[model samples]
Target: MYATIGIIVYVLLYTLINRKQINQHSRKKWIYFSLAICAGAAMLLLSDSSVGWLTKYLNNTIGDLTSVVISE
Candidate 1:
């Protein structure tokens, strides 16, 4: 309930704040990525289970990227 509302509010706030960045062709991808991050952060902060999930997601992603970069 609260998490859903918080996610919506945060998304709207992020969209407004980055509207100009989003319109820039080169920044479109980054803009969306930033919004996705904002949504993830908001969810993590709003929900107890979300924190554990987000932590695992971030750790795995970082670990994978590090391994790939180090292996190369």
Candidate 2:
């Protein structure tokens, strides 16, 4: 449901933004747009969990660096 709406919105926005050049390289534009959309969707799905891990990793790394600096 949400994904369908997102795809529709993306297509509409992509068409509107590319309205000027769409006719020039229609095939390439569509191929690239589809690939971008698929990649964006996959990233969106994975980002929630990935972000939490990333944040924790960053915090730990920063904490370790700060501890070393403070000790020195």
Candidate 3:
């Protein structure tokens, strides 16, 4: 319901913003951003009661990535 509307609005807004350079290539980038936003929104919505858990998970993920980069 709301998610569907949100996706529709996002598509409309994205199309308007990239009305010029929105060919096949750049359009793929838009789809990626939209998917990221949708995933983030879904996570937040599903874990509204687990904010602390999500924060720690995200922090650990970032820390691990940084550690790997630093080690390499």
Candidate 4:
């Protein structure tokens, strides 16, 4: 599907654009934590039910930090 391709392109583009930052962050646990986000996106290609699950999971996990970052 198109979404799958979009995800692949986005990941590749993002990684390419942020290669240095990613390498710099490689020593941090948060780098691996970020992969959970990609996994959640991939889940969307598998089943519709994953939408709610990932939404809740991401909101619980990353939501607060995103809000904090944005408010700054």
Best by lDDT: 1
Predicted candidate 2 versus true structure: per-residue lDDT over 1-72, tens digit per residue: 466567767767877787667667749667667756764665565446755787789879998899899999
lDDT of 4 by residue, 1-72 (tens): 678667767876876787788778746457645754784576578666756887888998899889999999
Clash count for each candidate, listed in order shown: 0, 0, 0, 0
TM-score of each model, paired residue for residue:
0.43, 0.40, 0.32, 0.45
Better of 2 and 3 by lDDT: 2
All-Cα superposition RMSD per candidate:
8.1, 5.0, 7.9, 10.3
State the C-alpha lDDT per candidate.
0.78, 0.70, 0.68, 0.73
Error of 1 at 30 (Å): 1.3
Candidate 3 lDDT score at position 26 = 47
Error of 1 at 53 (Å): 8.8
lDDT of 1 by residue, 1-72 (tens): 687677878798878886886887686888788777777776556657855877789879998899899999
Clashing pairs in 2: none
lDDT of 3 at 25: 65
Better of 1 and 4 by lDDT: 1
